[model samples]
Target: MRYLKRHRHVGDPLEAALADTALGCGFARPVQHEVLAGMAAQVPEFAGGRKRALAHAVFTMLGADLAHDDFGPDAFDVDALHPWAAVQVTAAKAVLGRAAGKAPLGAGDLALLASTQRQGIVWEGNFFIHLLVLHALADVPGMQATVDEGLGTALMYQRDDGGMPFVTDTDTWSTVTAGLALHATGAPPPVLHRVARHLLRVQHKDGGWSYTDRAQLPDTDCTTVALEFLHQLDPYAYRGPIRRGLDALLAVRGSDGGFPTYGAGTPSEACMTAAAVNALSTQGHLHHGIIQSALHFLVGSQLADGSFPPGWSRSRLHTLFRAHLAGNHSFRTPPPPIRSMHEQTLSLVRAAQRADGGFGQQDGSPSDAISTSYGLIILTGQADPAPAARATRYLLAQLRPHGGTPSPPDMLGPRPFPYDVPVLADAFALLALGHLSRRIRPCRAAVPGRRHSGSRPVETDRAQHHDAGAAHSTENTT
Candidate 1:
């Protein structure tokens, strides 16, 4: 059965197809990789302490996105790492560590490894890259354990009917992500077989996968994930499905070569285009006419700041807060971001670079770890230490020594409540600290298990600021 039947849409078929496709994708990849590769090349040691940590984050995001495409959302969320996910990360690290026969793995090592499982604050896709990095950084034993656990989870989640549930039957995005997670974690062939059977049947006739199993009503994002997952599972196994999916994806691309979130004449979407390129390339379909056009489209659309605009439209949290306060709580869907031609994508990212040495989420968004980390990954796999250092200082300043991170009053812009500091933020902060520590002598000496020689934990008075929900305690020693 199809995940989202075409009948469910009241909008034009083209609109439904495009919108559905967009939801299945996120921040585009060619842009992300281009930025990351540049940063890595610029930095001599991409995998060294801080750089390594940042690389871990980049990969983590990619892994999380890809795996979520394979598994479902329930498997992991962005704000907090699930205990089960941690076990899987830990297990994968353990097994991999043994494979390498390295020294005993440490907590930082596991954290570093686990960080690769990317679930941003919203549990959006992009957590699998973290798992991949976790495997890369983990000792053989640790890596092996991680892989085993991931595989086991994939097996446990498999349905008797062969298809994986997207959380609980209605989530095609979840199904695709869960499937990818299983593959990325290296599920056994038998399990792969069951999933493959299911994906094929569920795939839309138009060469894509969507909320429902149907024809011409597929989404680009979900299709991208499915294509990549199948490529990883067994390249030749779903060749037909892959071919059709790519074609449908290509059909949806605008004249600018970028794919829009919805129908023809829709604006180009940076994120969707990036994801489309990555998915197509991963599936060995990069040479396709549509794929080539997409690549050119993205390169043309590059921002001067070295970052893409929100593929969907930008949202002002301040505006949202005010609306909520006024009791006009209706959620409005922003229009799709305009897709750019090849040269534009490159120019956009170049333009988006902040003087502070990071990419902002959007032109006016705050320069926090979340945006910086994302920008760094796109511009350079290694996060720029400058922005990271600043963010680190800001994060530390927010810590009350006794409680959660809070937004200072002066920083408010209509939204006065404390912003939620996501798990990814904490992960990024720890990573930045780790990187900065390596550059400074005293800080460098303060690796895990080592006490600060001269500094002592200082006593501070508690403040009355509201907590940012489960304010992730800087509990793990910085």
Candidate 2:
């Protein structure tokens, strides 16, 4: 791994990717802000950086999407990104709007970086917001103190290269995901064992996990995926933590029989419910009672076309496929309706495949590694292998000597704007490839000297999934 990283030459993508995963224990020095930095720099005097249309392409794409989303003016659906993206866009435009005197000066008008702290992020979690806050507050009065603090927080995520990631401290989240991908392919290294053991040590008292070790708050999404990793690492060894995690997950169930991204009393979300059912049902008899209701909630929430309600993921297939796999662990025989939804979802996946054999966030959108990975995960083990095989080849073609491609961001952060978690694309590709390998040649993983738990990967609260998750094992992804 050191040889390739230092020598800088073409290498086998999978070997290089897995080597990267193992050495880092699955963490990546995450990056984002092509669009955002462009906007921030465009703020005229933004930290003395000049304006550039760095986000021109994405702006065009998102703008085209707004026409379909109705720009959400008459009504805003929080789940569908109505006002969230609108808020960011408004703040983004205010950078230039301020110059033409077109920007609104009212406090509500600026809506800058929202002082509201979602439980998902620590003050340090989202550095991009602090930078945008500076852009929005560029000329506002009585805000010097806030600006100073915001700049300090923003700089925390800055790299020596002078670019900053949208978020940081995703170490725990990245570790589990990278571990799962490697585990799916084969036994993970002892380094991952060390990392997972630490995860166990930090498991919240209530049996949940936050995205980072630095966070005090634990959400259902991270908790469930963490449990999946623990179980896959070694069910018996981590039984105590897994059980506590299950209890924590159940504690957060909404009245509708679904789970939410965060804790109890939050509204049940489609992807979260699906993930809860997947992780809970995997352990056999123990969680069937819980799974039934959550599965019901998820199925009821499904769109007529077989996709579940959209949340954190940009692609419908991301949650749709994970929900499909999660429901497979149905109590006894699957109910006719539940079985039918799985079939329907599978059909949708088949339908959504592009001519290139890869899948995209939407049927006609350009293909990307992240969404394609989710598609392959669901398509694997189907009666037909053609789709999954083709997708696999397409994915491999996209991988670079450095082990990544320019996959579009599928996850939403702080609501609607896409935030890149670069490792996810690689992790999921590894996961999908593993699934395809297993489907074609059904080889057993030789249990190594070390322990591992988990029957699978997981899906997200949104544009996220593990083959074993398609994954938060539903919806806001890590």
Candidate 3:
């Protein structure tokens, strides 16, 4: 560690020390430390006459990741870090997008970054997960203003009930989501204080959050998302509450190391576990023995084509409807279709991700932007032209000759939720476009139309729907 200081390799000495401690504790491998050190050496000290503090944070986080791997006797697997490469690719595009004035790395970019679940970010406890990722990668000259704007926009979605009203104020899921987004952008303390209080009061005795504060017993999705939000908002600030909540979560961890949606005996879910890993790892808790086993479980479960199943989301919706009926003696919402054809189909497609880049959500489905974006993130930074090209082709096909889709509904799969297509699908599409823009070098600028940019600023009143049902714990506004 002193060697860096002796050479003045150009970062905070304390950060270097932390990286050293993490590495020496076997958090990362010796070879990775060395490789990272080499990269750090290349990191010019005030060379551009101004330090890339943001880029430095990126390297520091990666360095810490190395240290956390426990200085493995087995060489560091470059493949495992593939996600970072893809992130870097997107980051580069974010830089380009910002420069080209295509779109600031706002909601769409935040969603993409949030999905990464990387470590060492200053979470600020807002709704924008990508903003946290951007904090480390935002090296572009005018990024802070964009951050401010994004924060303001995201904050506007917050509800009096302390949830982000995705389309309507009743959206508990998006409320917590909005809180995380605001935190990601480093929102003001006053805003975070309100969110924190809301989370605290709303948290169930089981240490999780559901549709409303009263919907107690805990669902893995909401629990994981809530825990992640708290961890990011103030890792140190909410340690006790977070740990208590995580304790409840730990009780549900399957012997296989993966987490079950409701109970321990059930088969493990990849997405739940992945979400759990993201939340836990972000809090520097990835070293837990259970997490290591869970990582093994996830890695082992990857299909031949390199994707995991739709575990949590896969529980038949009819079962959830029954559970909700039995628990409340009444149903609050209409019963949705049993199988989420699009979602379920996407799972199969994800499992079949091609080495070339495109992936199908189902075995036979054509590669599309949605699946490709997910696969690319899952693969990290690896170059997979097949998935990339196929996804690009799908997005292009959706275009109405005006460079944007004419109507948001046209791009939507058969699902009752409106936010899915806009936030989830559109975000994926934007990310895919960013990737394709780099890979194919499109002749003209590509901007997704406002037709689907979220029908109402995401903060207004919206219809009520719960595709995931009671068990899935979805909290969409409309």
Candidate 4:
């Protein structure tokens, strides 16, 4: 195994810049101090048990500093993290005198780590998962001995010239979302230009994109996201691809007038429809009959509490925020149905606010950084600033001094499998704070639509049966 002569910090200057941008967005000094203090105070809670303590120690070693206690043998747990993550955490703990003799690392542990690393990456090389594992290994004194060889193998999957993908060789979802966030947070033009170029190059011949470049199926979420990013970054330069993408987006409209995650036959979802409407309105495609049908579907989908059915995220706030954004972008003169749905959604979101100023995943779930961040972003332009302010306070309370926020574990994959990666939490927090500070730029320019020569029937793929009760993993998959 090849090893690097020297160790490097995984968290880069871009991450630090993002954190500073979030801070500059006008969080009060007292609020900042209070959040820092709160993070320190929560260390014990995170380290109270063996499972929790190991996770906490991993975060601290990664620079989040979630715990102050020496993570001794009592804190080590084989099942505390994802199996791959467990391997690295155990190694780090062993090196730190926390697991020596008591929970000593064995040959089996090393074999497992090497095998997992050799499998390339699961879920198509998710960046957060890779980053998490790298951070853990980098914390140990000699754990990076194999990093050079591992990274060399991994880099073989990178695209020739484009923004980094969520996974190797995929420039669809990750590139678009990252572009939006970075553009919003004032990332330089060269970076935005690079992202825009990659997006344009990878846009499927059908005018939309799949989660990964290799996946030919186009989904509403990825299509809309790509459109939104193009709209934000030099709309005119990439108008051709934007037009094709929008047309591809319209092609996926379900019979119910709502958008589905994948093909036409799939069930229409609120979040998918909301994303479509937002993209359409932003790009001046609001006049289409298909969009009106989507609007109706959105209004009809709202529950008594004004929440829409959760789509891709575990949190209702995620759906709510997307719906709200769709409404804002799509309607200059919303009809009664659209207007009523908007009002109800606002009330529901407001009512979901806990006394602690945080929002929960669902109506009765516990407060979390991810949900609270969504709530704050939704309330940013509202008439009542109180709720937004309160949510801001709640999010501030979750902030670690190292500029990362730790959210509760969220589910991923086709089945409900829990995955916890603190870097994701940090990314979302930065995005929400950036939005609140008005630092995030909005996409402009109306994309002109191209007319297809002949009418083609909307094609559908066989739908996978999903458990409604399972938390929808928000990994940008169709």
Tell me, by TM-score, which candidate is best: 2
Better of 3 and 4 by TM-score: 4
Q: What residue runs in model 4 are displaced by over 4 Å at the alpha carbon? A: 1-171, 285-288, 420-423, 439-478
- Which candidate, 2 or 4, would have the higher lDDT against the true structure? 2
Error of 2 at 463 (Å): 31
Report the C-alpha lDDT of model 3 over 1-478, residue by residue, as the tens digit: 3433342333333334444543454324554455445333332231111112223333344343322212221121223222332344345345434433455555654555545442322222222234434553455454555555555555555556543422222245545655654554456888877878787887777676664442333666667667767776677889887987787778778877887665555556655665566556554445456655665555554444333443322112111211211212112342232122223323544456554445544454455445554444322222334443454455566655644432222121001112232344443444434323323322332234434644433233322221223322311110
Model 2, clash count?
A: 35
TM-score of each: 0.36, 0.67, 0.39, 0.56
Candidates sorted on lDDT, descending: 2, 4, 3, 1
Record all residue pairs in model 4 with backbone atoms less than 3 Å apart, i.e. clashing: 207-245
Against the true structure, candidate 2 reaches a TM-score of 0.67
Between prediction 1 and prediction 4, the one with superior TM-score is 4
List per-prediction Cα lDDT, in the order shown.
0.43, 0.62, 0.44, 0.61
Q: How would you encode candidate 2's per-residue C-alpha lDDT over 294-319 as one tens digit per residue?
A: 88888788878877765667777768
Give the count of colliding residue pairs in each prediction: 133, 35, 51, 1
Task: Write the number of the candidate with greater lDDT, choosing between 1 and 4.
Answer: 4
State the lDDT of candidate 4 residue by residue for 162-199, as single tens digits: 22334444446657766776766677999989988888
RMSD values, in order shown: 25.2, 13.1, 27.0, 16.7
